[model samples]
Structures are given as structure tokens and as C-alpha cells.
Target: MTTQNDAASALLDTSSQPTNLRIAGDWTLANYKALKAQTEALVGHYDGNTSVDLSQLGALDTAGASLLVELLGAQRLGQLAETATHLPAASRALLQTVYCSLQDFCVPEKQPEQSTGVQVLARIGSAVDTLWQDTKALLGFIGLILETLVRVLLHPKRWRMTSVVAHIEQTGLNAAPIVGLLTFLVGAVVAFLGATVLASFGATIFTVDLVAFSFLREFAVLLTAILMAGRTASAFTAQIGSMKANEEIDAIRTLGLDPVEMLVLPRVLALLIALPLLTFLAMLCGIVGGGVVCAVSLDISPAMFISLLQSDIGVQHFLVGLVKAPFFAFLIAAIGCLEGFKVSGSAESVGAHTTSSVVQSIFVVIVLDAAAALFFMEMGW
Candidate 1:
């Protein structure tokens, strides 16, 4: 019998047909490094048929039992059953426990190598699949919103007037100053560029018409929608996402309340009312800014700028721009709420979906604006 101070050792006897492997000494964590190296070396010399003799093992523990199991493959445990019966009760129990624990151990299969071209194609396929899934999800969400809107319309009592008013204050009234300021600055820049370009051809007088036409027909609505996509959409996502993360949305549903009617409809209605007003404000500020730039840089008086705009630009341009506002507002609000509903119960999920809402809303607004422009051009509007 070996004491606790004796290091673990294994001896192999290959004189017989099936080799005998003898284990002795303190087979505990204290001698783990030496046991590990010795076990690994012994693995090459043994096979499934080898008979293990653990009867002489001293100071056996879980760690040493695990190494012994590794030296004698777990699959070969049956061959050592009779040998284990001759071991001390403690050593036998340790070996039995380790063997049973490692019985389910399996080597992971290696992935096959792929060529660079194949890998690139695989990534492209995955991206396309993801895009398709996103499109389907968005369409499904739009359908759900439409259904909820119809239900709310049928039930006048379901109209969340207070919530709608609050959102209008949040998404519309609070946003007006920044919207006006940004458009005003953009208008000044457009006027400066137009004045510079037109002066080269001795057509500086047309700069007023350029700014008015661009702002009234496209820039005003497009800029307002993009701003809302970033500002309002992200805000909507964060608001609803927080509610979801806090389990408040779940609690609402548990009480038999439709979250769509309570949360989404109010925001949508607010944006529908607000965007057109904001677009009108943007158009007014932009035109005012352009007129200021014209008066200062092109030697054109405010009177002359107004006269030029009245004579050259049509009312149809402003109408065309304002008509797209409601559509842009609906989509931005829908995307924001949809992404918010997607948020799982985590702060990280709320942040991720909020960012996704902004990106998707911006992308959709731009694409729809471009499509509308093409359609109007084709119709000769």
C-alpha cells in the first residue's frame, strides 16, 4: 500500500496475450501532472483488450479516477468490470462514478473545408435569406396594424385621445423647432449653391425658382420624413421596448387589453396629424431662408424673390410634397412600433431593436420617396 506522499505510477506487463496494466501509489490531485503525462504516454501502448489492475491503487480520488478513465477509454469499462470487483471499495466506487459520468462523452465532428468562392456564395445566400425573412415580417406587421386600425375605427370608444394628444406633443410639438432650424439652414445652403452655379451662366435670377421648386416639391417632405425616421421612430421603439423589457406589455395583455390599440394606434394617429403640419412648417422656413440668402448674395430684394417665386413656381408642387407626408408618417410609426414589439425581455434587446427601427424607417422612407418621384415623373405631374 502506498502513502499519500507517494507519487502516482503505472506499469505495463506485455508478457501475456492481453497486456496487464497495473496502477499504484497516491492517485490524487497532488500528483496530477505526473499522472496526466504518464497516462497519456501509456495510452499509445494499450488497447481495448488490455486488462486494468487497479487493486493496488492507493489514496484514490475523483481527479485520479478521471485520469485513469482517460488512460483506459470509457468504452473499455466493461472489460475491466471483473478487475474493478477486486479493487478496494473506495477505489472501485471512484472508478465506477467516473466511468458512468464519462460514458456520454463524445468527440465533436470537424467541419469540412470550403473554398473561398464557396464561402462567399454561402454568405451571400445567408444575407438574401435574412432579407427575405425581414420583408415577410414587415409585411405581416403592416397587416396587423391595418387590422387594429379598422377595429379602432369601428369602436369610437377605443380611440385613445389622451394618448394621441400626448404623443403629438412629444413627436410633433417638441420636434418643430429643430425641424424648422435644420430646414432653414439647408435652404440657405441650397440657395448659395444655386446662386453660385447659375451666376456662371448669367442666370442668377433663377436661383429663387430653384430653391422654391426643390423645397416645395421634394426637399421639404423628404427632409421632414428623414428627420422623423431618426428622431420619432427611435423614440417610439425605445418607449415600447422599455415597456416590453419591464414586462408591462405582458401584464397589459394578461388583463385582456390589446397592446396595439393602447400603444401603437395613438402614436400612429399623432404622426399622421403632425407630419403634414411639420412638412408645411419646413417648407415655409426653407423658402424664408432661401429668400434671405438671395437678398444678401444675389442682390435680389425680398420683394423680387416673392415676385419670382409667384410667377415661376406652381401650387401643384406644394400639393405633391404634402400628399406624401401622411404615407411617410404611417410607415415610420408602423416600423418603430413593430420593432418595439419585437424586443425581448432585456435592455440589450431594447437598444438593438431601437437602432434597427431607425435604420429600417430611414431606408423605407428614402426608397418610397424615390419611387414616388419616379411615378410622378412618369405621370408628368
Candidate 2:
């Protein structure tokens, strides 16, 4: 046993040819602190041809072997296996093992700097790739929902009527006040802006037609869908995401229950039933708001406003907006549930996916609405 005062040490003899370095004493944890400092100081002095003589080294351990390997470099340490065959069997074997393990090691190369234009192009390419992946995933999720829906329809006994009703109340009934209020305010603002602009051309009386046309054809349904996207979609993601995080979804699968049918179907059915009804309510509230604004600001009587609305704005405009509700509902529900299923058993994942669900649902609704409007216009509908 080497005493603390006689701890491990290394002697570098540059006076000798090939710069012979001798290591002696117990190279174990008890002497590691002193050994480490001595070994590190000697490392920079040694070259590839430097000879390491470990014949006198005593009581070697993994810690000491690693320190010696670090000092000699793995290649030089490997050469010692044959040249210093007089070393203890355990020490020589440990050195060889460490050297072999480190033989093929390499430092990672630094990334090259990219020009601004190249960076911008790279970012664009990455965004496009991500969008493509998301589109494929969404399409796959939609297919799963459709398949589950078909299975449920075929076996009417699997219908979750109670869950559907509860979700309808949550998504539709609970969401009505905010949706109605937002659309009403928007309608009032549109009416005020219309009256102000038209008054310049002495066409203030046309403000009623402006409000009716805009709300019936675009604002009511668009605002309602956007509201549902933000509110209902986030709710769906959080609810389902929590289930996923808790492994309740996994347990459902283990019991031979389809998570899509039990969880997703009810939400989808509820939204389908709720969105059209909500769109109609929004349209009525918005028109009423516009009518109120006309009476108050433009001095148009209620009867006159209604007469103008009835005479100028056709029911076809109302039908056009209402027709988009089911599509928007399906997409919003699908996106929310899809994001929920993407949760990775973390609170952060739930929050992140919930936000994604809202953004995607709103984006899909707006894009689909624009496409629908263009199609209708092209067909002169």
C-alpha cells in the first residue's frame, strides 16, 4: 500500500534519448488527485516517439488507467502493450482496452457559416418540408376519423349519444355568447364604416344593404368559425391531450376500445350539429346589430332597414355562408383531435399542441372559405 505522502508521481527524463517517461507507485483512487495534476502537466511535453515505462507502476485501477491513457494519447498508450510487456497483467490489459475504445474517436467538425441569402433559402426549404409533413399527417388523421365514423355508423349500438350531447353543449352552447358578441360588434363597426363612406356619395340609405350583404355572405359565418377555432379547438386539444398524458388513452386501447370512436367521434358529431346552428345564430345577431347601428347613427327606421334588407339581400347569400359551416366544423374538430393525439406525455407538449390546433383550425377555415367564395363567384352562384 502506497502512503499519501508517497502518492503516485510521473518523472519525465528528456535527458534520455526518445524522452523516456517513468511512472511508479500505486496508480489508484487514493493517489488520484496528486497523480492527475502530475499527469496533466506532463502531457504537453510528450511527443509521438516518447517512450512510457510503466514497469514499476503498482496497484492500477480504471481511474488511474484512464489518467495514464489521457497523458500518453491512445495511440502511444497502445504501443506500450507490447513494448512494456513487463507491466502488471491487469494494468496492461486495462490500458489496451481503453486505447482500443478510443482509437477511432473523432472531434465533431464545426458547421460552416452560411450567407444571408443561403440561410433564407434554407429556412424556406425547412418550412416547406414541415408543412408537407403536417399536411400528410393531417390527411392520415382525417382518414382515421372517417374510418372510425363509418364503423360507428354501421354499428349504431356503438353510438355515444350522451357524450355527443355533452360535447355539443360545451362546444356549441357554451361558445355562443362570445361568438355572437364578437360578430355583433363587428357588424356594428361595418355598418358605421359603411354609413360614413356612403354619406360622402349621398348614399347613406344604402348602409342597410351593405350590412346585410356583408354579414349574410361573409362576416357572420367567418367570425363564428374563427371563434370556434380559437375556443373549441383549444378545448378539444387540452381535453384529449390530458387523457394522452395520463396514459388513459393507452388504457382504453388495452381494453380493446377504440380511442377515436370513444373520444373523437362524439366531439366531431357535436361540432357538426353545433356549427350550423351557431352560424345561423351568429347571422341573426349580426344583422340585428347592423340594424340597430343603422337606426341609431344613420337615422334609418327599423322598418325601413328591414324593408331594404328584404328587398336587396337575397336568401342565397345566407345559404352560401351557412353551407360552409359543416365543412369548417369538421376541419376544426379534426385538427383539434389530431393535435391532441400528437401529445407526447408532457405538460409542455399538451400546451404546444393545443396552440397548434387553434392556429391550424383558423388557417384551414379561412383558406376553405376563400376557396368556396371563389368557386361560387366563378359559377356565378
Candidate 3:
């Protein structure tokens, strides 16, 4: 029901039916309180009549202003016949508009409710099933990679051999000095820590053994690969994201060129070619760094360091470390390129995907190193 009240009237001289309210005063809060009774009288006169006239009401306020609306709402709730009061044109239109809106709100409507515990569990089971299916798809992808690797192995000449060579020359040869320097520094740090403890036990000479064994087997290669993954992987993502934004990739597609083959294949091929070579370089530099520390702190001669390294480290251990590099390289390149393709139409999406690519590639590289370690151990390497 509408509540409209006015306390005073301004237009009462125009002979009007007692049922009709006429006001000439400015419509304000106090006016409606006085006119509420007159408006209610009109509604009572035609309680169930077809229509009621209210056109004579010169003005109305919020309180006595729109009782006709309430009258209509009450009638609709009781399924009673509705009435149309002769209201001023503006007032009639306003009341009718509000009446329509109230009808929509008051009508019964159906709504869906969420399920409880058991249903939630069932939904979770469905999600897990979907994840399992996606995981199977990922495995299928790995199988494809294995198949491609085998094909390339069988037909080395048909493979993108030049691309791989170029990447190796660029990524490995150009990166050699930096990778060597970093590994050397890392080895020095490791040797210092080992020496600090070993000297206390009068076993300082064993620092050489610790540095050689740890770097050759793990740290040197893994650290180099991880650094390259962060550097090269982020570069790949940003490059591809820029190309995607510029629609160059779309242009290639229009020209009947595969973006994957022309773009991704080269980077992937290059990293694979570079990783093993860089890992070998990293190990050499780390050994050199450890030797320097041995000469300075442990008083072990360079010749002795070299001779010990030659005798203690085997080709098999080097191969174990080398074998993991190409795999890590492939992982880095693939994740980076894939995330690049995930870029949307916004610069923000590109930045987010670029960061994700680097982080995911690094995580994958570490996990892969652990797995490789387990595999090599199982093989008794």
C-alpha cells in the first residue's frame, strides 16, 4: 500500500465531489498530512468499484500522495477487481508505473539453491576425473615428443640441423664466459663452506673431492640450466607475446606457414643443442674455481687438483649430467612458448604469462633434475 500524507490544502474552492481531492497549494510534506483523509475517503467510496476519480486533487505529497497504488496492490493480492481513479494526468502515469513495478516484485519466482555435503563431494569427484583426463592428454603429448625425437634421431639430415647448430653456437658459445664465471664463483663459495668445516676436522684436502663430486654430478649443470631457463625462457615468452600482439603470427598463418615450426622449433632446437655443451663448460669452470680455492686455502696444487679430478670423475657421471640438460632445455622452451600463446589482447595478460612461463619453467627444470637423479641412481650411476 502506498503511504501519502499532506496536512493542508490550497485549492478547495473549485466545487469538487467529497470523493475527489483538489489541492492548489505547493505540494510539500505538511500538505499531504491534511489531505490523507480526503484521499482515503475517495478510496473507500469506490472500495470495489471499477474506477475512482482523483483528478480534482490539485497536488499531493509523499504521505497522502499515492494511496491509489496501495489500493491496487491490496486488490491484486486478494484477486479482487482493480479500479482506476480519475487522477491528474501526471499522478495517474506515476501511479500506474509504480503499480507495474510492484507487480513484478511481488510475483512468486523460483530460484536455484546449492547442494549440500554429498553433492559437493560428487562435484569434486567429477573435477578430479576431468583433471585425470587432462593429465592423460599431457601424457599423450609427451608420447608425441618422444616419437618426434626418435624420428629426428633416425633422420638426422632431415631434422632442422642448422637451427640446432645455430642455437648451440649462439646460446652456448656466447653464453660460455658468463656461465663459466658464475659456476666458478658458485664453486668457490661451496669450497669455502666445505673448507670452513673440513679445516676444523683437519680434512681440508677433501674440499676438492666435495666440490668436484657435487658440481660434476649436480650443481654446475643444474644451476646453469636454471639460469638459462630464467633468462632464455622469459625472452622466448616476451618475444612470442610481442609477435602475438602485433599479429605477425596471424600473418604467418595466413601465408600458410606454421608459427610453431618457424618460430618455436628453432628456439627449442637451439636450447637442446646448447644445454649439454654449456653443462660441460659449467663443470670445467667449477672445477677450475675449486682448484683455485684448493691452491689458496687447502694448499693443494693445481696439478694435483687436475690429476684428482681426472682420476675421480668418470665419463659416465658426466654423461649422466649431460643427458638431463637436453630434457630440461626442451621443458623450458616448451613452457615458455606455450605460455606466450596464452597471452590475451591486453598488455597485462602478456606480463602475467611471461612471469608464469619463467617460474613454471624453473620449477619444471628442478623437478626434472630430481627425477633424473633418481633414475641415474636406479641405474647405479
Best by TM-score: 1
Ranking, TM-score, top scorer first: 1, 2, 3
Worst 10 residues of 2 by lDDT: 1-10
- Model 3 residue runs over 4 Å out of place are 1-170
> lDDT score, residue 355, model 2?
95
CA lDDT scores, all candidates in order: 0.88, 0.89, 0.71
Q: Work out the TM-score per prediction.
A: 0.88, 0.85, 0.66
On a 0 to 100 scale, what is the lDDT of residue 310 in model 2?
A: 82
Model 2 earns a TM-score of 0.85
lDDT of 1 by residue, 150-248 (tens): 988998988899999999999999999999999999999999999999999999999999899899989999999999999999999999999999999
Candidate with maximal lDDT? 2
Best of the two (1, 2) by lDDT? 2
On residues 126-232, what C-alpha lDDT tens digit does candidate 2 reach at each position? Answer: 99998899999999998999998988899988899999999999999998898888888888999999999999999999988888888888888889999999999
lDDT of 1 at 79: 51
